[model samples]
Target: MRDLSPPAPRARGALGVAAAVLMAAATLAAPAHAAAAPAGGTAEAAVTAPAPPMGFTNRDSTRCRAEFDEAYVKKIADILVAKGLKDAGYTYVNLDDCWARPARDDQGRLVPDPVRFPNGIKALADHVHAKGLKFGLLAGAGARTCDPAGFPGSLGHEAGDARQFADWGVDHLTYADCGGGGDAEQRYAAMSDALRATGRPVVLTVADQGANRSWEWDGDVAQVRRTTGAGTDGWGSVLARVKQNLPLAAHTGPGRWNDPDALHVGGYGMTETQYRTQFSLWSVMAAPLVIGSDLRKLDAVSAEILTNREVIAVDQDPRGKPGEVVASDAGRWVISKELADGSRAVALFNETNRPRHIATTAGAVGLPAASGYKARDLWTALEKGTSGTIAATVPAHGTVLLKVSADREWSQLPPLLDTTISGDAVARPGTTQRVASAVTNHGGAATGTVTLTLTGGDGWTAQPVTAASTDRLKAGATLGTEWDVTVPAGATGRHELTLTTKYRSRDGLTFTSAIPVPVLVGVTRPPAGESYLGDQAPLAATNGWGPVEKDLSNGESNAGDGSPITINGTVFAKGLGVNSPSSVEYYTAGRCTRVTAQVGLDDEAGTQGTVTFEIWADHQQVASIPKMTNADAARSLTADVSTAETVRLVVTDGGDGAAYDHADWADLKITCA
Candidate 1:
């Protein structure tokens, strides 16, 4: 058996000597294209070397597919350079598992897969360094790797592996989730000490699956630690990771971070809205932003989402303080992070499937009350002035990220205004809908000639019932106007009525802002009674692993991948099957009496998962099971929903980590009067 002891530290100047010897050998071993390291003369000049720079990595693409090879890596490096990703702070090109052989050499040194990396590891690292980028490699801690191929891991070979990686010019090392036999802390400490002994400032990442609550102690062991399990392309996965990572904000700082895994923005199955939410929340949480998509074929939408510098700036903030949850209620979240410039980056996130109007104040997000504050939407790159309130109607599974600063000259810009249409914009053909549009000015200076105009396409006509124009508005005043909007007689689908507000700032600058008022013409809601909730289609559903299943349990992945909805050992014929951190919503239409079901961790989870089941009526938690582990039997649950317009089924990761959290809502039935 190999030894698991820490490597012996060398003399003060041994690093220079080793570097010199490695450079001399590289002349003959490296290919003609590989660039040799600097002479040993310059090696001694380094009093200290910086750790691997905190930046993005491309590990997700390599792990999701089996296309891990030198050529693929080089192509990604090329794309990073040519597509301006390097300039956007994505500076690391990481090689995940399967890059090494199944066994070590006679000398017990891990070997690179000769077929995949013909030029060897040293040559590949040199190639990456030549392009002004850092190189990272992944290894496991167990006897065998987590990969299906079970490649050689760094379990008992941590010292030798660290030295080898340093010699090959690797700038980062990630310990995979499997293999350390004894105490996890001891194994991790052995590798951490070994890396330091080499005198190479290689960044260490501990991907321990958060099994040991690593964040509490990983600050000294690794530069980064995984705070949650591996993520999928689903929105619920993002939610689960964020939910698990939020409370651990205090555990993160300058060199240490809570990693929520890699980016799933583009090339994934999620919508652009969800992708932005993922990126925005990751930035707010101060998590590492590792790209997880094929960069060679990255789409324009994904590129734009990944390259938003304003958003990236928050993640790379010098303060390094992770965002803390300032407010949360019924699926709406507000996270606030303080930046080095005394500004705050705030994110208003809507976790539900329905559009929600989330509100917050500047002071609530760590900003002092000022005459006016400048709030810039990081995603849209739009700026608005606000006196105190910072709010928006966030889309479903979307976020509005803002950078708020106390700008004294905010009055020179456009006036900060809140536009709200009180009554529902739904109407019948040829029928008029009366709604009130309230415009509140939150700027420091008064506005001149504020006018509210409603304009729709051809057949739509809107006339103001109340005064639509104000000659002069004082600071922090609101103008309320009522309008009678007549929908087109033949309109049968959803349409929008544009409500435009035109006003002049104190600087005499004309500005116009528009808010779309949605009108569903001639639309009707389904009746209250629905048999076997699973039998009816949900208004919206999101699962962590795959699509939510009906009458079956949450499976490994993909829709229809599950068996019967079984809890403990009993199988139910009718109910919804979902992964943890999942949600399924139905329109109750205020006619439902109660919701009853049997909830538990699905038997498919074996003896490994834990989950919490919650039934929400509108914004209220009507019923919940505090905790249910795989060992627990199915528990009957009932929720009162006599006055709810909507009912939601929610499953969360029982306050541990989101791993194998398959859940079942068995025999779900909603009774209505």
Candidate 2:
């Protein structure tokens, strides 16, 4: 899987080939429109080509260090075919890392480790193909694989590896986790064009691991993309992957699936029930049916769970629509998927340690309550009968997967609850403030009376506020309200305004949802000629949003003024490297005329590194220090920020890099003209 790392040195020719692939994509990219559907199940979706492989994969998920030889690969392929997996859409068995030598041959050709694959890749492909299953291999975006001893990956060798795999009859090729280097989008596109040149269809799987937010860029390239990191064995790991992929349902469709790594079932760290939870969630998401546990050591319960046709059918549904996590509270959650025949596959999960009694009406889950629907348990394969209200007692970490079909058409299901708090994005301290909130009716029917409360810490108050109260709200309706809030005097930091509301769903189950309102509370303006920013009063940054940080290293490196700390303060902003941008913002009741400070790098020798400081008046960049380095010496800095309502101080990395780009803003001050 990919990670968040800077572009590392890549193969020599990758950039050149990347340019060519971009030109091809610009000309070939086209959107697939929604197509007509047949009644019942089995309708095809409007999907892009080289997509919708509808198969299985076995990576090293079960055993991170498990290395299989050619015989074991064939054995798994034979097992897949024998267990009727091939017929049910489990058709691809991929070879991960460890199969090839670390370096290429004299001719620069990737050579599989002779000891591991004596018959070579071609013979293995034949064996997989003979079993009516497809064969696949792995490559990385970097020059080397993630494995220290793994073969060189497919960076510059894209043109060669793509052709070689096609020649060997490989139908699937996974660009596994990168070597934490190079432009990910460009490298993947290079391989995309190379595979196309062979005139053979090969499905591309991008296991980019969400590093560069690859989902947005890889959509037009890889058919299936990994939305999370490499999978590990543990219930926490299983749930961790699930938590990452559920919200990305909107990004998935007919041919594209948001892979949450794989179905690492029947392995250590998970119980029988937890295994079913993993299976149910993957199926609901229309994910690949790739099971990574050793097939040779399958037990009765594991086989029964894996071979469940109903669950597999959800993943293989021809409609190509994936189920999504519609609503969740505490440990109780709901996930619903649209089916091919206008039906819906819904799952209710109890993720906590105690049993939970969950309930939902048919109309609440997008089914017409008027039309009685028949239900069945996917796990037990038992006919669970029909009713307008489907309720169950789900054990901890267990789920209820229901296939609901109605004889008559149903009214659309409403969003369970939609609440938003606005108008408080920015607030001034020491004053009564007002914010607006809008709550909508996303249930099947009308709701009862609702109570809302606004709460905050640090002596904040929201006691006396008036707005419209709701006695009842019809389906799909909205109610608007307001709140007058106030933070304590001199509150000069980012604070959260929480709105806690109690509402009951259409099925009469009450839920408490707390919504956070992010607001920056500013302090009073500094007197003219007074120091408001420096080592002592470091520019307070917005935690999750701003990259600027506070540190005390000026004296340690003799950064500027030969002071250990800020001129008279204790901290300064640092970590200002390339792409490591940091900023501090504060509101002023009175306009500030100018800002001044002393800045320098923290290089031990004072010979390397760079820093660029910019000042933003409101949202506009009014002044900047273009490029300063260690050799440039610590110097006085000034910027005209006159009549500025909001002022921001930003420190940036120098041109070369941020290796030792330590900077200090000593005696930083903002003053009036």
Candidate 3:
């Protein structure tokens, strides 16, 4: 990736001294590489030094194939160059497992599969090199590679394998851990030393499944370290990797990186929203943008997501520092990464199943005090003015990635004022909902008298609780206004309320803007009779793998791919199945009385899963099963919800990893009046 190439000049200009102020803030946050050692010490600083530069690769395409031949490998190389991917920064054609023979040659050297590579590995490498891209191969540290075919690995023959790969002109080597390897550090280091001794510049990528806290030691051992396995393209897998690797940002720097695995965008395992979230998060994490899908089948949407230069810039910033979480409330998160240009990449992520408003201030994200700020949405490329507040109503499992700069051209734009709302937007007919709007002046100059007016849809009424106008407000001042909005007794759907604000700039120019606030009316009632939980659509479902299944076991990470719900060889006709770290919630309308289900680890998980089930009514836990395993029989469970407005079904990993933790809620039933 020519990621090290100087980035194109950024747009400049914001009202007031916002640009200058933010530049000062960036000066403080973006420190030089020679800065004093952090809490970790000099060794840590040394490892943070820029490592060799690397481009993207087609690693996953080969992995998805059963057995790729020379024709296939060359085809991928052609696609990488011809599909605009190479121009977009992808520059490697990599081969995964099963590319080598199970046994070595008479000379004790690794050999390419005879039938698959009739022309040999050297020819393939040359073909790829001729396309102006590098070539990469995978090897195992143990006696055999991870593939079931048990290809010969580079365990005791590290030097010999290194020589063979070097002779083949291999540019990148992925050393994975499998086949009953000895100590991982010793094995990994042995290969590292061997590769160096071969007088070749091979980029070593350590794939140890994040064992032994690799971030703590792999910086010197390999150019890149796997922070986690390449999990399925499920939301659960993506979420898990992000949570595990997010705190290890301190270990990442130029040359060496903490990789959370391949890019799963444009895959079938998740929705478009979730895919965008993955791309945004990976870019901010500075993780390698390894394309994990077949290049031949690449879709337009995926290409767009992968080719967004703005997001990619955050990953390839000259500073090479990973983004870190600035603030978090429950499931809402605000992450900030400092760029080399004195700008900050802010990600307001909503990890919950419901839409949520996430907010943060420039000061909180390390921006200096400015009259106002300019925020550009990296995804939409839309530029907007903000009065210090950076916020958005993010969809479930979505992210709002913004490139925020201070005081770019403050004088050209009008005085900066931001408006926001606080309070519930849901109500029943004939009910009154109280909501407050706060307007803050973040301009460099004071504003003229500001007036705020509330108007509602037909049959709806809105009245201010007090005066809605304030005398000239100074810079950095806030005005709070409240209103009582009543829903018409006949209303049954969404009603819109417009909050309009009118004010004048210091130059006597007037400006007006209207913000729409939607109010949802009517209550969501539970089923009128006893019903199977699978029959009702959940208000929210956050699953560890794929989407929650109805009347089926959580088979794999794709929707509608699960088999019938089963536990201990017992089949149930009606229920829901999910993976660990899962939650399914339904509105009960405070009329539900009882909930019953037979729950256990599904037989589809073999004997490898262990999970615990919990039932929550409203916000309180009403029942729980401490532990259950795939080997155990299905157990009966129940929860009382006589006065509960909502019921949640949850499954958690049993104090261990969530791998294979497929759980079931067989024979689930709920009674409501």
Candidate 4:
């Protein structure tokens, strides 16, 4: 097995070296191409790249389907107009997966199911374009669509498929796992190249499912990449996707954005508050605001969520910076984005099961109270004045989205710490405790030789465990270290542990954490033969035992043979045969010992019954009251056994007739003294 421990400094350096070598190899294999020349003979140039077709939009039927009909299509056009989505810059109405048919026609062209799309894709695109919108389509990278055995895949048929989509007026195309083919990047590039050759400026949306960290490099090949799975309307799903995509914010741009799948707002399985929270998060993340609900049937709350201009502004901001989490805890979180106008858009989210008051000072978010700010609650449509700081009572799984501008002038505020720290703690014997601290440097400049002191309790000693020698933390990076300290052993009640970090320019800050370590005097074990035993049967139900006899013949049983069992339980056979050639055995946990049993026909064995027995703690098997077995009779035979440590038990079939040589067990039990 590979070592799971964190890599040493030398090993990390070596990994960087290996990455450089791999990049060099890739560069050599495929020489970088030059950008196409611009129309004017100036030094500037234009770049031509493979992209998704123009009119594609991702759709989810579980939430809403982009069905093709005059009424439905017109309704979507109207909703887009009413919401001003078109004005804000959303155009294509792309159909995601699950919209295709099972087979293609003899002409090798995909056939849209007439029942769902009677006017066909072309008519739908025409209608959308007439309304100033575009139509897009979806297909799988594998042989079959997301559907089991659906339409033919777009693997080797990339060129033909591109032409087909072009002919159908497809403006955008979303491809997933393409034909489930070659390397993810290579396959995506191939499809993009194929689409580009079709003389159509189709916008290519590569759905890599975020596998292999493709979002980090896919920007060069596709217009956008899905950074997470298909989205759900649930708040948990939205929060999870947002947190996962935050690291990829640096990769987003005008032509490419990190898609947190689609908008689940106003969809099923979400409350009004949740929908608002979802919209706020997606907008802050700069994710595509592709609505995934029945636009015509939207409720009032859904309409409000989808049309919030302030929230939408953060998403459609020209700067295109994805928001990053600035503060996060069990109940609250804060994410911030740098806007193009030298301002910041901050979102304070409350994701607990209940309402919470999430507060953050201006300094915490890198803002000065001297710069008076205006806070707008996106969900409530209310505006509040702030004196360089903001705080609010956010509902459960809800948020307060704000736009903080530094244009306002106010009195200067005291200097404060810009760094934040988070960590976990564990208890140890004596007066010592172990704590791991993750220090985040949010300041513009790097910090050096910082000291973290632990105070309080009767006696406390702090010693750095890791990252101490360097004593430097770089800007925008986090440094983790452990500290071992001694606290009075007799301390029983909660005591405060203060962390103080000193820097020259920045003010020294103190953060207090309460720690309670209970004292344990002694440990005890259960009395002999009364200890609990852990045992479980295998999950599979089958006819043959492993590596043992394929089939049991005559009056023989396949019990315990070749199987491991805990000897804690009573060993038994459901249906046992006397005078049969059948037996089974099991190995103990340590494999130190084996137990076996055999039943033989007695001279006076006239009646058909069962033979019961028990095993004692001394590893001795004892016969209990004897029971009779009649001719062609089936009966259960059980035996209880005990051992010093733990052991295994085996039961064998001893019977006369071949038909009576089997025993079946419905249940087994283990009893402690």
Candidate 5:
């Protein structure tokens, strides 16, 4: 006989008293067995014996049973034993439903597909038992097995099926909710009672379709109850299920556990680290460690992560307390567990797309650090001092699990509310309106009779902002309220809307929000200017132009009669210097043939200084001079030119470095009628 001593308890430290109180409350609230039975009458009970203390193999019987040859059954049993499941406190290898043929034999008995299990189910059970493991079978709570195509069901023959399992040397049974049964709790209890009536200790695993609210009803009638749906062998699916189980932790205990479906650690689509995280969370939650992956084909890393004793201890802790989420956002979560010993297990998880720094302090978790502390990183096998805080960098979609132990006595912190302003609110002109403000409570307790006041707003009259109702603002909760105010007509500027909240503190500690309300009044319009050609206009000019092109000179010429004229040029080749000029000079001419000119240039490279040029024209429009380009090469250049009866030109350097050297041109022509 093997010694199956109960798992060891966790070390003691802080958080012990509160955790114990909560655990006691949960035990008291657990449902009684009799409450699980179907209402108003007992049907014939099943005769299946309770499962033994041995791990089992579960397979989809309907599809593969015909191919379930002796070689396959032996291979499965070998893998289960090799994984040391029996030695690690697991038994009852179960075969999932759909193992039977469409119809029963003439004797009205469920028959295994002859070709799949040629030697029969009983023979398969014998083979499993010979390998030091238990064999279990599946059935549905509905009238028929899940074979919707028409197969046998346990609906009216619960007891008869139990008897069949008992006679076949079956040690356990997994009852799934199929065919849309009414009241899953009732159905589960019926099957449990029927199986127990056979005078066997058959381990009963129930699938409640994630709707049984098992936390409110499960007791001794079920050793384990499905609280969520079946899972895939992917990190996302695994993490989702883990989060779902967080709230359900209060319902798990000795001889009863929250079934987060089954394990997929070594299965398809999961990385080694992901599998480690999955196994770690499951163990911490004290969930049943059922294997869903193929053990025979598992890699060494998968096997090692699944079997770490230190991490496993957290899961199998005798206290059986479930962890809860302390904080979560953007794929990052902080979870804490109350251990049997006084310490708490804190896990900081980064489920984001990138690595992130996560930190948690005893004060943040409402734990006292007066006693000092130590943190042991379970994944890395490293220890650190956590006198009052625990912090670490978590990889993308990874986690940091630490055990915090305090040496002195401390009390949980009182709840608090932290307020922040999201951004400035804009109020439209000519209307009195209520603008909503957001407030979040980060405290440990609820706040009552909270009042908010609008301090002041220049040029604006403040009105009362109404809340949905007055109630206690609980910790970790958020609420929104609007401020009513009138923006006077023709108000065309910005204003500050200040607000403050008043509340009495039950714990003798007052909390206040640090941010102030900044509101903008009146609409913001673009400056008065000609609307440019682009969709956005003047804004486009500043943003659209590429790098300046050097060694290029260009400008627009004007007519002498004060009218604008166009200048034409033909480019011979592209150059590497600045090709565009920033500003254009305008000139005027007074005569019938007046000419106007604006010089523009496109500079690709920024190497350019002041380039000098000379211009000649009549007296109405004179000869003009061009200076050196600015240090910053011009992207576009334009110059306004005008014509006159007589004109003279002079050119001088403006201290700019590079000249317009690429394409040389001499004649300047301006158009005037």
Candidate 6:
């Protein structure tokens, strides 16, 4: 089967939390290995959205492609509606490539392939509607699809093709292309416009497919935004596709969905357990439950899995909030969703072959730990009695979906808001640095009221600026502003900032988001020389790091301020370097000339933690160690900073946990001429 979306390396972890201002600077700093900058800005986010399709879909590209015609489509529709899929929301039958002829008629309109659909597209659509089912068609956004058969695409003919689709009473149009026309955002928007002009409501779908990061910008232009590329049949393919959409959960909701391609249940290369896993995962993610398998060959196992009314209810919940991975370890994965009614939907996934025991407490998922709730297994449709923790024995590649309802009302759409600050991380003791703050709405509905208050950090003067928004922000939309932060003259140490966001949901529920932001400033600009041994350094700290003069944990400072860091098990912060390691530290030297610092990975070299130390001078890193395991010895590093005023020390986890990142600067000091 030909897949409409292109393939690429899998990318994960797109969302994160708030860090202190100064630490955020170190973590947000450009990495040594940086990718190309994003091409589209916030404007690309879909604003005006079309009405969403509230039903499940079945597409041909997964198995049959465009091989079958009128008889085959009607047969599948009959099976679905007859088997009770229609009432359960499986209502669309989509026709993919090879459905159209190579060329249009004399009027330059698309013509159905005379051989495949001799009865014409309108006739088939009519047949579909006669059964109370909707019709869906697939076309490319370019001159041609990857379809070698030369089926005329809807690229330059968006309006004409759209008009034809509307006239034929088509209900769904999946717009995918190989990128041969203008901007992707514009091309898709054009089709949306053309379809709307026809005066018929069509569910327009654009394949975001990782190429354009379409999930971020494919605002309401289309009903659903395809998040991943085409999915394969096997379990490896299924898990790969599923994990890739983890960080993207924030970008999807009610009106728009993050597609993980199709569902291969009881289909080619799939098993009963894989089927359950796929179905359960899709439901929690709020993904479209499109059946890519054969509806004609429904077995007891497949039918039982598909018609689970309880599972379907979770998917079609009115709140429209998607589920996300809360905790993962070894072969066990835990995902959670906050249902509209304040209930909780939790799934325990076993990825390995052998059966595994997985358990999670209600409190871990926002439910009161001590509060007892009724637990119902969506798979078995049986109550497991009321309990605080729900534990299950799951088969390999199998999933257990549980709907936990407590006595307390906990209904809310959730917090889909994330804020980011940009500008300068470095500020002079007496001057101000103007930075921008951006808040992205990744939930289902608009935010009620958003307010930003800046509580200034230590050793600073000027008043802290604040901002707020009362207007409701659209899903996938972003709002931002600039703030002027000043540092008082002769101030010292690290400046910590507390940025708070107080907002309400559409339901009039109040929510507050407070984040810590740290700012770095040198005590003196120039002509002031400072020196200290590695363990005796007074450096400002970021996200996880504490005051440089002493260990915040107190336990790790046992090596004494005069000696190197010796005791392990105290990793406070991990820098913004690779994999967002366990912790990160940033330091700046003022008016330093030639600085020689003796850095050691661990004072207790006998420990098992791994730590790497790096020195940064101005824009480029002067010296560094990449792989520092527990057994590696320490060394002295010297860098020339005569022409520079700021230098940073970055520490990272060495492909392991930060339990032993007992780094120490024995003889760390900077002197000016």
Candidate 4 residues lying further than 4 Å off, grouped into runs, are 1-58, 62-71, 82-89, 98-101, 104-108, 114-119, 367-371, 380-383, 409-673
**Clashing residue pairs for model 1:** 142-179
Model 5, range 516-586, lDDT digits (tens) per residue?
45444563322233221111111100000122222223321111111111113323232211111221122
Error of 5 at 512 (Å): 42
Ranking by lDDT: 1, 3, 2, 6, 5, 4
TM-score preference between candidates 5 and 6, better one: 6
Best by lDDT: 1
Residue runs of model 1 more than 4 Å from their true location after superposition: 1-58, 64-66, 425-433, 449-464, 468-472, 484-502, 508-530
lDDT of 4 at 533: 22
lDDT of 3 by residue, 143-164 (tens): 9998887888899999889878
Per-residue CA lDDT of model 6 for 203-295, tens digit only, reads: 678864555667655543565777665665566557656766766888766546677777777575677878888988888887777777777
Q: Which candidate comes out best when scored by TM-score?
A: 1
Per-candidate TM vs. native? 0.88, 0.55, 0.75, 0.53, 0.52, 0.54
User: RMSDs, each prediction?
Assistant: 7.0, 13.9, 9.8, 20.0, 27.9, 23.0
**What does candidate 2's lDDT look like per residue over 1-673, in tens digits?**
1111222333335453353244324322222222211111121221222124444455654322545788788888888877776766677788877778778889878887788799999899888887777778888777777666645888888878877887777777878755655678788878876765555556688877655566566654666788766665445456656766787777676545678777767665578888899889988987766777777776778877877878887776766677876678755888888887877888988765434556676777887655455566687554323336665656667888988767432233322445666664557778888888776654356766666788888689886356545777776677777788887887876676677767654556565655566566774566656455442333344211113333444232122323243322333443221112345665654467887877655444256556687777765778777887666555677877776666766665454323344465555677753
Supply the TM-score for candidate 5. Answer: 0.52
Model 3: worst 10 consecutive residues (lDDT sum):
1-10
Q: Write candidate 1's Cα lDDT for 1-673 as tens digits.
A: 1112334542223453343234223322222112223312122221111211334455666662656788888888898888788888777778888888889999999999898899999999889888988788888877877888788888889879988988898877878868558777667777877876666656678888788787765555666788898887778888889988888988776556688888887866789999999999988888888887778778888989988988988887766678999999988999999987999999999887655678889889999878878999897677878777887766678898999999987866566777667676457898888988888887777888899999898899989999998987777898999998888889975687778888877678777776667676765444456567776667678888888998888897777989988888898898888888888987666778888998888888889888899999988998999999989888999999887867899988886677778899998998876
Q: Which model, 2 or 3, shows the larger lDDT?
A: 3
lDDT accuracy of residue 673 in candidate 2? 38
Full ranking by TM-score: 1, 3, 2, 6, 4, 5
